[model samples]
Target: MTETPQVTGRHRELLDQVLDKWSLHVLDRLCEGPLRFNGLRRAIPVVTQKSLTAALRRLERNGMVERVVVSTRPVAVEYRITPLGKTLQDLIDALLLWTADNLPDVERARARFDDASAVAGGE
Candidate 1:
């Protein structure tokens, strides 16, 4: 009998990192083009400066985003998708499409789960 391979902790960790809200938003914004810090903040209005900063730093460290200093007078930095990041574009688009197609079903399932959990005092 052949055994099936299990997903390692590292794979789960990487999935968590890539699928986070901030990472997805950052990647989506960068898909349009390279953007400065303020530009990214504008594109993702709900993200706090500190959170965005952290997200960008993590993405840069993960080799998914590139940070370039393009100006020196007052100092300016821009974030762009690395080749690896660009490869994720199709995955992101698939996620978007799946969400669009199944959001209602997901919401309905959530509502039902919540109701059941409430009745059972499990929520």
Candidate 2:
């Protein structure tokens, strides 16, 4: 019998860094192509400048994204996914596909949990 490997603290921290709310969105956008800060904001309208800045910094720190200076005159910068980050695209896509495929099952499970909770609350 084979046992599943346990997730360590570093594993959880790395997952949290890449899979956080804004990180995924930023990655998805960068997967399309490089974009300036404002362009990224426009692409992901729900993300505030502050959140986007924080996410970009985190991703850059993790070597998943690269920030480039396109112009010095106006001080323009663009963000692009590094080769390392591009490697995550396939996995992310697979996860999305899995979610789509299993959404009905998930919904049913959620319904069952909610029903049980309601009954317990009534009791």
Please give, for residues 43-109, the per-residue lDDT of candidate 1 as tens digits. 9999999989989988898889999998778888989999999999999999999999999999999
Score candidate 2 by lDDT: 0.95
lDDT of 2 by residue, 3-103 (tens): 98799999999999999999998998899999999999999999998999999999999999999998678889999999999999998888779989999
| Best candidate according to lDDT | 2
Clash number by candidate, in order: 0, 0
lDDT minimum window of 10 residues, candidate 1: 12-21
What C-alpha RMSD separates each model from the true structure?
A: 3.3, 2.2
- Model 2 alpha-carbon drift over 4 Å, by segment: 1-5
Itemize residue pairs with steric clashes in candidate 1.
none
Candidate 2 collision pairs: none
What are the lDDT figures for the candidates, one per model?
Answer: 0.91, 0.95
